[model samples]
Target: MPYTTAPVLPPGTLSRSPQPVLPTGDGLVLRPWRGRDVAAVHEAFQDPLMHQWHIRRSDSEAEVAGWIEGWEKEWEGERDAQWAVVDADSDRLLGRVALRSIHLVDGLAKVAYWTTAAARGQGVATRATATLTRWAFEEIGFHRLELLHAVANEPSCRVAEKAGFALEGVKRSAALHQDGWHDMHLHGRVRGD
Candidate 1:
């Protein structure tokens, strides 16, 4: 059979033009990172859970600044979208939610998120995930979205589930974290799923 390429973006749909803010309608907002956010990023990375799952945490202001700059470049390149999850009123950085490893030709992307220690139990991650999921499916024209986390990280599992990502099973020793090889739980959601 002759090959027919699938159209990733719906007819007339365009690539995301970076937005300044995405309000989640309950006091939560997703916005692009700013230079002034370095301090909050440093503080959030101090959480033990953050260090365990994410091994590339910045230990110095310079590193975090570089990280933020990288995110900006990623946005400009249309490869990823990284947002700082913040409180609407105080504008305090609660965490981050991102769409990574975007495959525009396949209309797919992976979701990743984390919350500060103070925001952990308050459903920050869940809310951010849900909000991002909606935007990716609706605005970005992604046909499918996925979330993956270490199997040992129960909190992340909860966040994925609450955001309507169905558990898709596990990949044994799929990720190399700070503690070494780790089994990963894969969860997914498709448009209208």
Candidate 2:
């Protein structure tokens, strides 16, 4: 693992200050994605839990290439910011956490994340969520952040709870899982609320 410098902020001037890279308790650093991260990301995506929770199998090589392209675009300020979670001590890629669906006007964004199976039960998701949430509220000045999880994902729900996100409510048949439609728990945390 190597220490990579932060991506240059996107072209247009941002109304808010640039988001800073922060380190979590276990020397896990939350920073922007890099080209070298593609392999690690692809490896993590191969995990069955990752497929069930995040990536859709229909995601082809082209689609992944497009995503990596978008990652650069996002870094250049053309899109919402995303990050790769890396170990500060070993500089190994552990997972990814991002604030997506950014609506600057509404002051709202959705937080989504997944950890490598090897990193589970180590509080990686919880710490990453907390670090990113703090960045969203303080650095990006977002008023609200949302974390949504499928009802079946107990571990994810626990991560949300541990990160201080309130269980707002569940939407019945909100999304279609592989088997069928399922409920989704929507968790929220607001700045100063």
Q: Which candidate leads the pack in TM-score?
A: 1
Give TM-scores for every candidate, taking all chains together and pairing residue i with residue i: 0.93, 0.84
- What's the lDDT for all of these models? 0.87, 0.77
Where does model 2 exceed 4 Å of error? 1-19, 58-63, 75-79
Instruction: Tally clashing residue pairs in candidate 2.
Output: 2
Q: What's every prediction's RMSD, in angstroms?
A: 2.3, 8.1
For residue 119, give model 1's deviation from the true position in Å: 0.7
lDDT of each residue in 1-193, candidate 2, tens digit only: 6327432232242424444577986689987676777667777777878767663653455566667677656644524767778898887888878877776656777888888878899889899999989877776567889999998999999999999999999999888766788899999998985
Error of model 1, residue 17, in angstroms: 2.1
Candidate 2 lDDT: 0.77
The sequence of per-residue lDDT tens digits that candidate 1 reaches over residues 1-193 is 6338976864333334545578999889999889999999988887787889886777888889999988877776666779999999999999999999877778888999988888879988899999999988887779999999999999899999999999999999999987899999999999999
